[model samples]
Target chain A: MQQTRSIEMGTGLFVLLGMAALFFLTTQTTGSNSLSGSDTFEVTARFDNVGSLKNRAPVRMSGVTIGRVTSVRFDPDTLVAEVKLEIESQYDRIPEDSDAGILTSGLLGSQYIGLQAGGSDLSLQEGSEIEFTQSAIVIENLISKYLFKQDSGSDEK
Target chain B: MLRELYFSFVDFLRTFGALQLFFLRLLANSPAILVRRFGLVVQQVYNAGALSLVIIMICGFFVGGVLGLQGYANLAKFNAEDSVGTFAAFSLLKELGPVITALLFSGRAGTALASEIGLMKATEQLSAMEMMAVDPLRRILVPRFLGGVISMPLLTAIFSVIGLFGAHLVAVDLLGVDPGAFWQQMRSSLEIGDVWEGIIKSMVFGVVASLLAVWEGYNAIPTAEGVGRATTRTVVITAIAVLILDFMITAIAI
Candidate 1:
């Protein structure tokens, strides 16, 4: 009976340890955004095509993520996607003239908002709109345009 | 020439029909056999799960460490060392965690199962069971099959956890990565679907390994030499089956 109790205790410990380890792994693997202190600022970028731009995807500047896309909606009047971005407090000094482009990481990768810093001394405040935004350029559209241009050039020749 | 070709075609069909009949019988009796062999299944699960933990832990740790080191080195070349978490999670959850764990389990458990059952056959113990009105399939094979089915996903879950933690230790403790940043990258990178894929693949692998081992053992000829041959075949066949099934599952899932 003593031996059996010890074995039971050991089994219980093993299970508990395993569960703790599993929970740690799950939390570590899924919690990327560790923004602290609730000092978030919002900004908006309008684009013609978000193109696989998922909500909560990172907003990066110079390959360092400074924010995430909070929500994406279409302006019924303009037929443009109004992407609201949540910028962390530390990266609040983005200039008014900064350009936000919907860029792909690779050929078939997810879309992210890439901010190109402008040479403006006047920094944008919270709730300021980034007006100079470039929509996602589909590779297929670019290829077709290039082919058409080649045909037109051949006719000229 | 036409007569010879017709004979060969008939022979092929006859063999195919025999195989179909065997499979149908196996499938028909599987559930009933499994129900009757519940105790045996529990014992097999206890043996496989408890005995295999230490080796699985060691292998999981080393595999995770190597992945982290290699991933960190490659990403460092491009000044993107932060992406190591993503690489580690992707490799562990999608491919290495399930396949390596199953392969290890097959080596440990699969060989043991085949040899044990093969020995029973060689000693006329199976025939004695038949004389005693005991169904050997229910008494022996079903327990092992059910044990493997139950243990595999549990083992896989354990392996994935150990592997991730091992990578974290190597990256943050051994190497000079910030724990916060490493975890941040990992969290941002992995999806729930990635972990689900590993667990699902492991369950399938468990079923295949157990089935193959039981089949090989049951069909083994009654000789010491035959038991050795069956053991070898069980390991080889199960390993190959695991890889093939891994590919099929990945193709479907992805």
Candidate 2:
């Protein structure tokens, strides 16, 4: 009976330790490690297709995560995804002319916002709206459109 | 040909009826069975969770390392090697972690549950329990069922954490990914829903494994050789169930 009790205690302790490890690792993995000195700034980009662009999706420049998408919504009038991004203050010197494009990392991969900075003396301020954002190019849609275009051209011929 | 078809149909119906009867018995006495078989639950918890830790840790380490390596290789083709953590987290939490852990547990614990109970049946222990005015389902099956239900999720949690850490070590230490950047990518990519889906899958797997084990064990014929057959069937069925359930859960969660 004592042996059984000790084994039970050991199992309980092991499970508790495993739970603690899980919690600690989860916190460490998911905790934001961005530069603490930077103030938070918001930027908005509108796109036609947000293709797998999830909330809190990374906003990357040169393959480095600089911010995250705070929200993604549809503008019923424009039929576009209005994506709001929260960027760090230190990297806020993005030029007003900088273009944001929805880029696929690979074939059948996730979509992300890739920002290409333009050479401009003027910097974009907080709450600035990026006007020249390109939506994700859906591969299947592109293929269908190409095939349909060929069919139409043949009829015209 | 028609006669053979009729015979096959009859056999299938017979098997189905037997399975239905087993489930009926399980549902009828679930609560009472659970209460009476608490000790067995504790024993199973110890066996499945504690004794299995070493194998789980080893599997976790290899799984993490391989994920990191493969993720890095694929991302490297596009110079996106920095996104390894995001890949690792999404893969581990969304699919690999729960499925692999449950598969391992099913092979180890599920098979054991079937054989232990099957042997008991073969040895006339179940009949003895019945003769002594005890329900075999309550005395034996309940404890194993409860053990499985409790142990699986806990083991899955352990597997997920260990696998993530293993991936981290490979990505950061061996592959030379900046630890800070790796974690930042993970943070920005993963969501609460991903973790919740993994835990939910673990629980479902637990229930599926335990049910399959009990179903196989309780139906075993009273022969020493029948015990081994039940054990093998229990493992195969439980493993397949885990895989099929994983796909269903993934479709819903995604």
Q: What digit string (tens of lDDT, one per residue) describes model 1 on residues B1-254? A: 99999999999798557645544555566677567655455567666665677888899888889887988888888877777777888898778988998898888888888889999999999999999998886677667767777677777767877887788788778877777877766776676667778778888888778777777787788899999999998889888989999999999998
Steric clash pairs (candidate 2) = none
lDDT value, residue A29 of candidate 2: 56
Rate residue B249 of model 2 by lDDT: 85
Question: What DockQ class does candidate 2 belong to?
Answer: acceptable
B1-254: candidate 2 lDDT, tens digit per residue: 99999999999899878877776776677777567666666777787778777888799888988999998889889887888998988888768878888888878877887888888888888889999998787777877777787777778877778888888899889998888878877876666667778889988988888888888888777687788888888888878889999988889876
- Using DockQ as the measure, the top candidate is 2
DockQ of each two-chain model: 0.25, 0.29
Query: TM-score for every candidate vs. truth?
Result: 0.69, 0.72
Looking at model 1, the pairs that clash are: A29-B187, A30-B187, A31-B187
Please, what's the RMSD in Å of model 1? 7.9
Measured with C-alpha atoms, the lDDT of residue B44 in candidate 1 is 74
Score residue A13 of candidate 1 by CA lDDT. 52
Q: Score each candidate by Cα lDDT.
A: 0.79, 0.81
Model 2 TM-score is: 0.72
